[model samples]
Target: MSIKPSRGKPLDVGAIGLGPDALPAMADTAAQSRFDFRAWWPEDRRELPYELEIGSGKGTFLVQQAQQMPDTNYLGIEYAGQFARYAADRLRRHNLNNVRMLAYDAAVFVEWFCPDASFRQVHIYFPDPWPKARHHKRRLIQTPLLRQLHRVLTPNGFVRIVTDHDDYYAWIEDHVAQVTDLFERQPFERPIGAGEGEVVGTNFERKYRREGRPFNALSLRKL
Candidate 1:
């Protein structure tokens, strides 16, 4: 069952050997665009960098990445069903092949979804900062989770993170510095995607832009 949506012409990810059929796990969603198919993996092939984008709040970045990098399979995990469905629907509309979505909690499948040191790149863009000291523990890039990310990522593989909170950024720099001698931090601006003059206009990026906030992008790799 092929998915054909109303808007955004379906892309031919299958033609370039980047389509869904090759990833049998996607066969379950052949009918429903937003179906859950986590139980379909075999023993050996369960963990492939097949890619992981955590905290996929909305379809903006994940959807765009999926469409652009059809050759590199991608997965998006968002807790919000509306966003998940919208992204799935959008991906289906694009007729993209190398992308699949999951509407589950990230912590639940972090280990089971893939094997140790499998992903080459893990993205966590604009995760909640929990600015208040009282709520700081809620921030995503803490010691345990950071170490977990480090464990699951291949050596030299990167965990790309972005945020608009200055305090949070500084906190991560301090904490990660204590992790191991291999991590490097080069604080970046304007993000990797938005070109000059192109509006920094995702739902959150736009909010930051309107408030005169500068975005911080960093990549941490285990070496």
Candidate 2:
């Protein structure tokens, strides 16, 4: 179930016309409710391998991956409501049932909804750098969150991350190295045709490429 922030009460799913094809919006106010994957997803998908993407903007990467790997279930968590809604609509229009979107805090969703050894892979592309020294604490690739991610991933599961900010990439590497027992850095091989002006994983990646910026891609395997 996708959770969206609500002012007071949760929006009625029926009134919103969010059919099964569209990502359902659970009320942000309903944090007390536990998320059961077996109950949330279609009965047939309960046994499928699952993957997750954090900060999936506009659903470009999520849609492409889901279409390429129809047997794998994909879930995307986006903080922006507009992007989440747009992505959901796009998925619905394409009639893709393997992808879902949530418009809620990624950290909260991971902590509350994700189960142990649940995901086969997790992707985080172009997360906010939070360049300012004072805002460094807000960056997503911190030790605590990495620990949570480690717990949710299956044994030998992988986390793929990409960033255009050199400093942020260094920071992420440093933090990830601190948790050596749970994760190990793995070499990432960029696709043969991936370069400037080429569409990579996410929309932001393309934009950055168009701006002549280089990206650093990292992969870590859960131990």
Candidate 3:
């Protein structure tokens, strides 16, 4: 297969700090969070801590959360090359040193990189629903994915799933609701558990939201 590069796009890998062994790490918010976001993160971060975001779109929300809640560590996993760079650039441009990001599959990272009971929160925002029958099996929200979510999360770790597909939303609701110990759905706005993944104009969510699509979000905790 041949991959053509876009014009004038210099590939700066470090812009997102994605490298071998996934060694290290971004920020507090810029008054937008209505709180002093930069005061919570540690000046000397050395180990795993609290929260993370998967499929971090343009990284706006992740950046804000990292800034507002500095006490908790944040990591973003995104596969798209440009968007990963863009997320990294946003963190750097904002001078945030509390968050780290990687361009790898959540399943792979969950299976390999993350330690047991490492994360307090897992954010899966606007994941590909894979609506078609043939593609349904490829969707990220599956039995195996949920199992991984449960394993990597702390005892009470929470997984927030956000989507705009009504059918997919119901399907997920039904699937997770059936799992006794693996998951339990909480209110849509489960404080910090996970809500509708918020469609706050992330270049992609905006397109879906503007079309008057019915978005669904839920937070499920690991039992």
TM-score for all models, in order of appearance: 0.71, 0.82, 0.76
Question: lDDT winner among the candidates?
Answer: 2
Error of 1 at 46 (Å): 8.7
lDDT of 3 by residue, 143-195 (tens): 76788778878888888877888878877877786676788777655334223
Report the lDDT of model 2 for residue 218: 89
- Candidate 3, residue 92: the lDDT equals 64
lDDT of candidate 2? 0.75
Q: Report the lDDT of model 2 for residue 61.
A: 82
> What does the lDDT read for residue 15 in candidate 2?
18
* Backbone clash numbers for all candidates listed: 2, 0, 10
Count of backbone collisions within predicted model 3? 10
What TM-score would you give candidate 2 relative to the actual structure?
Answer: 0.82
Give each model's whole-structure lDDT: 0.61, 0.75, 0.66
**Cα RMSDs of all predictions?**
8.5, 6.8, 9.3
